[model samples]
Target: MSKQSEDLLPLWTLSTTETELPLSLTEPMTPSRLTELRAVLAALAESPIATLEAHPLSAPADTSKGISLGRMSPLAQELATLAAQSTRSVPKAAGNSGEVLYRMVVPAKVAAEVSGGVLEPMISKAVPGGVRSALVGTNGISAHASFVPATAGAAGGSAATVGVAAAGAGALTVAAPLVLLAVAAGASAHADHKRQLEIEKITALLEKLHEDRLDDERNRLDGCRSAIDKATAILLDKGKIGLSLGLDTAVHTIDTALASAQRRITDWRAALEKLPPDKVELRQLNDAIAGIESPGSEFYVHLELAELAIALKRRVIVLQAVEHAQQDDGNPFESFTNSINLDAQNLEKIVTGLRDVLLRLSTLQLDRSHGMRDFTFSSGAVDKLLNTSHRLRALGDRVEAGRSQSDVAIEMVQKVDGSIVVLPAMAAE
Candidate 1:
């Protein structure tokens, strides 16, 4: 390859490992609640005659009409989002209220400990009447009905209104009783209508919740697939470079490896079948996407670093020429002040660019094992990243410390030359 062509290749090497993190499934449930949920799920799955009680719909006072996950309480919104993602319809029965299940998606960390009818209790105090459960089945796990307390006497008032109406109607021979009977009848009917409205609202909220989660998972899966395609293109280019360099053996190996990687992408795409959005399924899809993204992200970072190295190298050449000009023919310091100023400004610009690169690296989410329980990195790549950051920091400090125009100019020249050595060595590694 020509010098220019060789320069086009990354100066720095990138490395990554295949990482798959198990999604979490542990949700905080009281021991009793977990038992009840297990029974409910078991009965629904295994028993022909198992029935679910129709709990009264009591909307939490703080809950908004539109369910916005992550806007309200983090834990509550998480639960709601999980419930939404897990929503699924079980078999429908003519006489019975057939079971409806919302698959619970928890982190893998949580799932590991939630087994054998044992729940890890994290709450110091049990919520008053705050019993929650999750039903696990072969297909997936689902959240149980969660009812929050309503306004103080809403439930009791409806029953009382009905009784009042009946009592007044029985004594209607008296004029006062007749008037009382009419008022009680109106109140009773209103209460019933209000309860029915609440039920409908809650039902709509649940449906919306399910739809939102379904859409979110679909979007995420699409994003991951797109990223994989992009990564595939990049790897193909790298393989072509190997071929151009007449590294026939290396090229053949790269082709084989890339082909396998491409097949994995296809497998991942197929795995994302339009299954019900359960925690386990969604988590698996997410991890599969991350597998591609981890390496892809690392690749781009090194690519940028290589480009920056080239630019720095050119800047160093310019600084050398400027320094030589100042030293030769007894050129006065004042005469070269303007030239020095220009170089100082340019050096500052490079510093800014390097800072941005470091920032990107810092924010990058590397491949983590077991749901980010442990962060993993390629030792070589990590060393390069840290060294680059340190050099940039030291250079920035030197630039900022320059007091006068001459100091700024001379320091900029020295730093650029020093960087040329450091960066190329990093790339060669």
Candidate 2:
């Protein structure tokens, strides 16, 4: 290959043992891992001999041309921007003829422990000469280049020196052994760099996916809270008249149910706050997301139950009004009948709505692993409402029967003739 092509290849690639970081690059970075990576990058920014730059490669092996930042993943793009901002000025070596670049590829785990404190130690130990410049990417790939000054007739120097000499002589000359070593080293490093970059891209994708899942959870929580608040307001309004109409039992039951719902909402909010900020271990990530998505506390079911309770309370109040009207001398029979019929229709609707809410509560699949308990408070409230429904139905039946008897008496009086009609006992006397 031409000299231009050769310059694009990394001089040497060093990596952590494969067994140490067996995770696929496409896998998510655990919260700890993300933290470690940030520390390592920060240290790289402060290193004296190393200056990190972002190489936006189109493909892992296509290092010749860099793609735009828009084409990269969010994490990758973010790191690239950071790398730009944190880049230190590269100190130029006086009278340096050229530079030999060295590249290292290590797992994020190793970089955090070793390079986070200082990069010079690791650089001096890994590369043959003093590194002049370096570039690091989110993929755990760091490329370093050392400056070498060209002098006339320099013999038995490093491979870079020999190459410079060969080029100046305008002849195809090779220091056979040094050239072989350089070729082998560059080839190995290039291979490792390519593999590491591939893995980093995968990690970026996983991070994005995890973030999307979290967004969905937040939105769901917001909707649940809004619904609960609306239901609470309605229940509170209904409870205001409880004392006036001797509905203390109904009011207390509903208030307790509302308190239970509010408590669950608080628990869910706290759980959400405790979720990992960035990413989590693959083994635990699925469980964590599931917990948020389908928590056992049942906020929605509680809201429905509360609304049902409110409907039942309203019906009871209407029933009381109808009873009071019956005793009023000005109340017409037709008006009393109309009010009773309306109450009956409303009662039927409440019963139907309650049944639907109960069915939903039964079929709901909650995440029981998240310490979910039984709905004792809500269940008790439902039972109370049901008993009230039955009693009201019975009372309406009795009222209708009494009304029928009164109608019969009135008809008999209207049918009586002007002359007195006496029973058989009275005529005999």
Candidate 3:
């Protein structure tokens, strides 16, 4: 066999970010409570073969994960634990046995509805005389125990993903009515008044995440606008250096700057929607931004400009990432030639990643209301229905893509000495 060259570029790739959180840090289940819960679990196991039972779908109790039953029913607050705990469409691996984890990350307001209408409706009463609500809840009963997973950071290194082996399974498949079934099956007269101060507190810190992301997008947009202003001002004084490539340098610069501003706004709004309402910032910023709409253009010219701006930003981020990677001990640069940029290996990875990003951008361009395959499904009320629908759909791998770190290409500026110039050191793909 012929010998192969040792020079091959590595790909730049970003790890998948964590999209879930723990519910709590404190253990709600006391030692006495755990003993009591174990008793209940035993009871359910020993229940008659024909008896029906159900455990509240809430996560099991643990000090590490901070998820607990807390005498609060799953119906009361769908997000008492992590909001990202919704049912995964992907089936569990074969032959896996343990708690089958389910997540329900409802919006704060919507969670209120679920709590009031389903979870803790019967536990409290405005009037002490009523037994009807208790009667309904008495038909089925569930006992939930809470547990916390270890802090996510201490569990994982560098990357955000929790250790897969440590993340326990969700609720088990039982043959009987279980704890929830028993709660519904029968109730004491005191059951209606028992620990009546039930309030389902969501442990999902989504609002913090949302506001942070919104600020991030907004800051990025502001940065783009600032860059354009500075660049435009500098160019007005220096004037265009006649490239004679049939493209006006000044006009294109302006176009690129404007494009960056628009893209930032788009990103900001999307991030805002992803966050919980409680975590959003004060209305003061909202009032400041009110009616101050960002530029909107339907023309392909604006679109091209925006694309250019994104490419510019991508290029910059890539280089910055490279600088950071150079410090990484894991970098495989030792095997590569010194003539090549240290991060040339990572370049291919970023370029590949950009494909997924381009698809997202494309979807945003194609459908403002529904991105990708998301479509309006409600009958008459289109806006409400489409907006309310759960965003549980996991984007497929093929739909995702990336770009090489340096793939955001600009027109090559040919120099007298024959070296081609790559402008905009840090540009987006």
Q: Give, for candidate 2, the lowest lDDT window spanning 10 residues.
A: 406-415
C-alpha lDDT values of all predictions: 0.25, 0.27, 0.24
> Which segments of candidate 1 are over 4 A away from where they belong?
1-337, 344-347, 363-429
For model 3, how does the per-residue alpha-carbon lDDT over 1-429 read when each residue is reduced to its tens digit? 112122111100111122222111123232233234333433333221111111121222222211122223221222112112212211120002222222211122211211111122122321221111111232232222222221212212321111122233212212111111111111111111111211000112222233354334333333443343333222222233233432234334534554454554454345444534332222221232332111121222223233334333332322223223234333312111121234333333433443333343223211123336546544544443233221101212223233222111111111222222111111111
Candidate 2 positional error at 397, Å: 25
lDDT of 1 at 202: 33
Worst 10 residues of 1 by lDDT: 420-429
Question: What number of backbone clashes does candidate 2 have, counting pairs of residues 3 or more apart or in separate chains?
Answer: 2
lDDT of 2 at 32: 33
Q: Write the per-residue lDDT of candidate 2 for residues 297-400, one digit (tens) a residue.
A: 23323333334333333333333333333354243222333444454454344434443333322333222122245334455545544443343233233111
On lDDT, the leading prediction is 2
Candidate 2 error regions (>4 Å): 1-296, 300-304, 307-315, 327-337, 343-350, 357-429
Query: What are the clashing pairs of model 2?
Result: 101-145, 102-144
